[model samples]
Target: MSAREEVLARLRAALAGAPPVVPAPGPVPRRQGDRPPGRPELVELLRQRLVDYRAEVHRAAGADVAGTVAAILAAAGARTLVVPAGLPADWRPGTVEVVVDEDLPAARLAGLDAVLTAAAVAVAETGTIVLDAGADQGRRALSLLPDLHVCVVRPAQVVGIVPEALDRLTPGRPLTWISGPSATSDIELSRVEGVHGPRRLHVVLTDG
Candidate 1:
């Protein structure tokens, strides 16, 4: 036999009696949602947790969503705002210049003003907001490059804890979990804000 065929024949001969490889099993599902016993409790706990993170939180009714959002932008003096493609038209404020999320480069996005979005989920116990780049939430770069971020979260989307949040999320998605504004402390224990992401984070909790 030729050299290539001889090598293949020997390899086949070597494994002829070998057992088939079996895959290891995955971990068993664990108990989740250990805090915030009820829906109302969950929402209240989420608000408290977010407040502890130093994030601005606003409560609004469903019918007043547009007005609340507009007021928030105006109060921040944001003249330019980035809107994701799937964002609801009613959520846009009429007074600001709107930029659509279209895979813009980081440098380009950094120059713009703030970004407004709806979250995929929020964890009450951890005070975390997750964005999966779905619909109202744009690509990861959109939220990261801006100096300010305003997010709208519904009470229905709030979960009691981290594991509960994970159960709602799809696997292998690009997820961004934000607790508050981007901040860090140096070796001297000096705190600084706006170093990595937005320096300001505003969350509007809707009861409707």
Candidate 2:
């Protein structure tokens, strides 16, 4: 027999007693209470995971969000800031020049010192922050081109697992999942940061 035929014959013999495969009809329904309720521990776990990924983490009361944002920008020495159209006005630091994004060109975006945005949801288990291009989050380029990214996450927006995060998101909107500052290693294992995206990530978690 030809080599291809011989191989096929042997595979059929090996599976002679194997059960027929069945495909799932749809996504399995999650059990009730499978999703953990929001708690202080979830926030703490998120903080630990974010720090482990080398992201700067800060906590702030709801009323102090603007001040916390301003402080972070000042410490980073950010002279110019880019923000989405729907970003809260108070969050824009008075110390720096703020530019609201209006489909800014890539060149203009690259020259900015930092970008501030509100996250749609965050996964504590994986230390991932997601952006859904909502009014508070501009197009993907806003987050991708800047050197520094400061994202604010509310306690209610943080989830314990990926599935929970997914359930909270809409399928049609463009989503950006960020774990940490962008980095990659070279052939000799030398680490490089900011090669693909922002080199610095600062997460501000706000208490409700």
Candidate 3:
């Protein structure tokens, strides 16, 4: 049997006599007004949260998204960019050399300059963005290995709170929640970025 199959078989055997575990209660739902926040308000809130996390935030109209993306890459001096197969064509900057992910090796992905993706949903309150390995968002590795991650988020995808964001995601899908760039602190409280993922996060909040 394959290594993965063997591992699962062993795990199942070990749990054969184990008693069932019950899941705890979920979060208390918050009551909402008859009307949610306006789109512009949600977008602004999300931008504020992202900026507080030290992420670069840029705004663009629907027609100007491509130009905005191009400018960001140019400013970052990124030459080689990797993206998912289904990322919107207009979002890919013409100036940079864009490569589509094909289950590339980790080492190869780490060599690339940056990665661009479309977020599944974003929480305005917490400055969190979620990717569900969707068509526009590829495997988790694509975002983790690169030094720079440029994620495109639409205004419609921004939710007011965590519970609302959770309701929009599927439990079975591989989900990546990013509040900012990857960072950690040592015992001495020395902050280091990009320990587990990208060091720089650039979020493009587009009207489209």
Task: Report how far off residue 177 is in candidate 1 (Å).
Answer: 0.6
lDDT of 2 by residue, 1-208 (tens): 9999999999998879675578646787773225463578888888999998889999998888778888999999888999999987767777788999999999999999999999999988889999999999899999989899999998888888888888899999999999989978874796666677999999999888
Pitting candidate 1 against candidate 2, the one with the higher TM-score is 2
Using lDDT, rank the candidates from best to worst.
2, 3, 1
What is the Å distance of residue 103 in model 2 from its true position?
0.9
TM-score to true structure, per model: 0.81, 0.82, 0.82
In model 2, which runs have C-alpha deviations exceeding 4 angstroms? 1-37, 186-192
| Number of the predicted model whose lDDT against the real structure is largest | 2
lDDT value for candidate 2?
0.89
lDDT of 1: 0.86
Q: lDDT (CA) for every model shown?
A: 0.86, 0.89, 0.88
Residue 23 C-alpha lDDT in model 3 = 61
Q: Is candidate 2 or candidate 3 better by TM-score?
A: 2
Write candidate 3's Cα lDDT for 37-69 as tens digits.
Answer: 337788898899999888999988878777888
Q: Give per-candidate clash totals.
A: 0, 0, 0
Model 1: weakest 10-residue lDDT segment is 29-38
